[model samples]
Target chain A: MLASSSTRPRRVAGFLAKSAPAVISVGLLLVTWELYANHSGIKPTILPAPSRVLEQAILNRGALIDNAIPTIRATLLGFACSLSAAFVFSVLVDFFQPLRRALFPVFIVSQTLPLVAIAPLVVLWFGFGLAPKILLVALVTFFPMLVALVQGYEATEAEIGQMLRAMGAGRWRVFVLARLPSALPYFFAGLRISITYAVVGAIFAEYAGAAKGLGIYMLNAKNNFRPDLVLAAVAVSAVLTLVLFGLTVLLQRIAMPWERVGREPSGKGRRG
Target chain B: MSRLELRHVRKAFGGLDVLADISLSVGAGEFVSILGPSGAGKSTLFQLLTGAEHGAGEMFFDGAPLDDHGRHFAFMPQRDALMPWRRIIDNTTLGLEVQGVGRKAARARVAPLFAEFGLVGFERHFPAQLSGGMRQRAALLRTVVQERDMLLLDEPFGALDALTRAALQRWLEQMWRHHRWTALLITHDVREALYLSDRIYVLSARPARIVREIKVPLPRPRDPTAAAAPLASALEAEILDILLNPQPFKGHDDD
Candidate 1:
């Protein structure tokens, strides 16, 4: 009874300590914004208070939900395509030297092209359905995961690879057994980075051209002089990005359960 | 005839010669060790044997030319090198899975050896979860599970603490006594060499060559305390002398 009682307070303290910075900063910022909007006599059309935004979001709950579904679907589908393609391309580049040499520079160059600039052209070609948005999201998010996987493959320990080869394991076996597992941490790191971009990419693609999405809703709200609705939609997108980021972390935890075991301090001495 | 033999195996990296005319042989089921100082090219020779590097050498396995340098040996390096993402059982079965065995079949094959390796109840544990000695044992289990014709161990206990290293050395002896696997070990420790090998080859510092071949006629399952015994002490002193004192190469026994 004593242990349980003491542990509950300790756990709560730990949680509070971890989240204190985010909570304090965000709360302060929102309070300052509320005070400025009220005292400065700013027009609500130009600067809606956080309260007005929250109220508008609640009032338009049905429209918000309808739009959020399509955005979520497009983001997930596009992210999936990006993930599989990155994996396949990474493996091919790892296995084939010529392809890596020929295409690596091109891949980097592809990243340099402002992805948003191309979104409209993609929409022009594919039409303003889900295709262009999915394409844009996949295209924009592919590079980080690909880079992570390739680096991860390279990060494989040379001795481990040699050990595997000495066991009569061929190239594929060495890759599957050693290189692949070594890359998982890097892959997850890449996933975390890409998942955030995935939502932003989806939103940007919608901004270019889309039948319905937060990007379109914000645009419509802006034209109607309803800044509150636009701010509400922006809040929703931020929440969406955060949720996807958390899911990526959860996936990593599940995929690499061994990583939960903290590494023991290696004992050191003269090598025999 | 020896089960494996190397004749005039030579390797040089640019201006530095790592191995110069080193030749050795090991009979079937014999435990042989190569002893040398750090950076004496002991590991280089193993790398060459593993086909990770190419060198001018002739290696024979079972009296046939060893064209396929790696197919006959299971190698265990200094570090455990366990995959951090895999469970202990899966890590141990890596070799079998590489050889095209189904994952389930490979797991079943190595599951019985976990207990023998002192890894009972750790079949589901990760390498990070195990102590240093346990990880090393798991590495050894990974090596032996292959059932290759020979085992190449590069300072298998080199990374552990003194107590853990001693415990593992004793455990290895007991395991080897029962299995009688043909093995070659590379190490720098004089006592470790004296305790484990049927024969020990002393190699010279860089541009390493076999300086002397000493036979260890000590009985099986030798005690770690036996280093204090006269015969073992004398052998240890002699090996240490050879390692510490550098003699000018006279080419007295080239072959």
Candidate 2:
């Protein structure tokens, strides 16, 4: 306990040191942008100064928060639906080879169909409401998770399945015992990718049409020649994406606690 | 009556014959081994017994046709197939759980064997947290806890290094002596067979047929140091020669 406590600060310092380069680079870029916007003789409408964007963000914080609430709700709702739909579909594909062969290629083709193009149509069909935004987000996010789950299920060692079967396990038992657990890491990997897109997906759907959201706010701000507000909205959306991504990583750790335990340098160098 | 018997078991994958006219038997509580070179279809024999693969065969378990596949045997593969997600205790209880035993009951049943299997204090630890030898022991514990009629072990210790393999072999020998479970082991290691089994059936390469059956001329709970002794080394050399020299496949004989 004493040794670990002593090293705690050092470990934290190590982490900060490792991330220092990224932090420094981003800081430098922001500084350069701030200086350029102030002195480049460009109109504030085209590209507002960082200070103006921050000032607008603080001034219009109420509007930003209100608009953000709707977008956040749609993102969370859509992603939950996407996650369940992906899991159920992946299990079906894993169980039925014929279904996998028939549907997997179609799903792959569907991913390439440009969610941007489809968002307008979805909004047209469902109208300017929360439903279209949720549907659009679910559509855009479900495929990565589906592909991850399918591949993860396939990644189980054949001998493990054979061993399970020899123990009187039937098809469902084998799946529960071997395939599902093996797919967890892959599931999380797919989840991380999907989540990074969730807020962006929700925003894009709102861009096509929406009653109220960050995307709608940005659209209004852009039309009204308020680039500072537009930039503030982009910042808010980026922050939302980061929060969701972080949540996914946390969820992964909680779900698969064994992985963390495995990485702790076991004094016994044994792997079978 | 023998606990398990296979008569005229033959398997051919597509056009290639794997196990050609194989027959063997393990009497009650007897430890038997199928010794052969790699790709000698040694595993195919176990596969046949487990009904994982179908072939022309008559399998009898206790004077009856062995039709119920799951009831008769517990199988251990080359690698310790413990799910990385499950705790060591959970892994050991997996077979029992599959047999319709409740998790709580299964845990209660296997709780005592953890100490015996050298897995004490690792009940909650995952497979990855333990050493390779411990993991294999946990795998064996999983198989043994099921309390099946026999164990079909396909190169159970083949993946371990020489030192760990030797240690596990000695441990397994002691376990077998105590439990007297009927076990059929497949391996290319001559010494492993000589050390462990009451009888060893040597098989010819591919289209495998039983080339010879030798009764182990050693006593129970055999000393590992005795492996270097004249009698054991001589038998080992003889088995190695038989494995190295491929005899032509003669036509099937009706015994």
Candidate 3:
């Protein structure tokens, strides 16, 4: 009981340690921006204070959500496309050695061709429709997922697989049972990265061609010198990215619940 | 009355010869162990027995050619080597899943054995969630689920702490008595060898050959304590002889 009581303070301290720094950093940035906007003598339109951004958000919520829908749809669609294709393709590359030999260098080379420069061409081919934007997000998101998954699958415990084989497990069954689950952590890792890429890809494709979206809104607002609205769109984009990334984290927690048993809390480490 | 036989088994990795001219046989329900120091090719022999990698030799399981390892035996590695992604129950049922048994049927088979192995209430936990002995138990359960009468075990208790290792060895002794399965175990622990094995084969250093075979005169269901006294002394003395001064011997010698 004494030991348990003693640990409570330390446990509380540990929890605070991990989370405090990020919260503090974001808090400090908001405080600094608010101070700078109020006292730096900049016009409100050029650099809207945090308060002004909030007011603008309240005023333009409907328009923002309206413009957000198409891009969100494109992002989700592209994410799903990339996920399925990556899953199938990665399995192909892993299972067949000759195919891996033939295709891996080509994949690397494809990634090397700049996505930013490539976005306009995709927009041109698919036309200012949602298809190009979805393609762009898929293109951006596929690599990490593929790489993570393949590496994870390949890293299945060699000894255990042999043991399974001795039990008469065929190659396919061995892979499905052992390789697939082992690759999940890597899949989530890729998903976390690809989630960010999915948002950025959708925005970039939207920037290239779109009837409505935060990207188009920001561009038009910038042209009209509505920097306040542009920044507001940027903020919305950031929040959206965070939400997608957070979903990956939450999924990870669910998929790998065994990892949580002895986890140290992230509460107090960032206090300094 | 299934028996396993090895005839002139030879194995090499590229240019390095790991084992040469090995021959052995185990009758049905026999418990035999290969005892050697580290890197003495005991593990390589186990791997060859399980058809992990092909070696130049004839291996017969139950008088049938063991062309493929999956046919007549089960293998447990030096480590628990459980899949970290799978739950304990799922991991134990891997053999059946590999053999095309449906998950439901496999779980049905595994459910009864969990209580026998002291693995109740923890079926849903992953490999990383289990302790060392528990992991070892899980691996054994997986082997048991295969229901193969012949087992190839390579240092099954090598990684466990001493207390756990002793406990597990006794548990293994009990299980072997209850199951009456044929097991070919490889171990560096002399005490483990004498405690569990009916007959123990000692191998020479690198490029291992059968140096000597010691038969334990102890009775079946031998308690750890009974085996611990004379068996431990004999093992220590023989181990020192194998290491320091192994006088050249071509065949089995009791003196």
Best by DockQ: 2
Off by over 4 Å in 2: A1-11, B251-254
- Candidate 3: DockQ? 0.37
TM-score of chain B of 2: 0.97
Shift of residue A227 alpha carbon in model 2, Å: 1.6
Write down the worst ten-residue block by lDDT for model 1 chain B: B246-255
Cα lDDT for residue A132, candidate 2: 92
When sorted by DockQ, best at the front, the candidate numbers are 2, 1, 3
Model 2 is docked with a DockQ of 0.71
Model-by-model DockQ, in order: 0.43, 0.71, 0.37
- lDDT (10s digit) by residue, model 2, range B154-212: 99999898898999999999889999999999998989999999999999988899888
iRMSD, per candidate, in listed order: 5.0, 1.5, 8.4
Query: What is candidate 1's lDDT per residue for A14-40, written digit by digit as tens?
Result: 989999999999999999999999899
| Docking level of model 3 | acceptable
Clashing residue pairs, backbone N/CA/C < 3 A, model 2: none
Residues B67-118 of candidate 3 have per-residue lDDT tens digits of 7677678889888888766789988988888777899999999999999898
lDDT of 1 by residue, B124-201 (tens): 877777788888999999999988899999999998999999999999999999999999999998899889999999
lDDT of 2 by residue, A114-203 (tens): 887899999999999889988888888888999999999999989899999898899999998899999999999998899878888999
What overall lDDT goes with each candidate model? 0.89, 0.90, 0.83
Off by over 4 Å in 1: A1-17, A263-272, B14-16, B102-105, B252-255
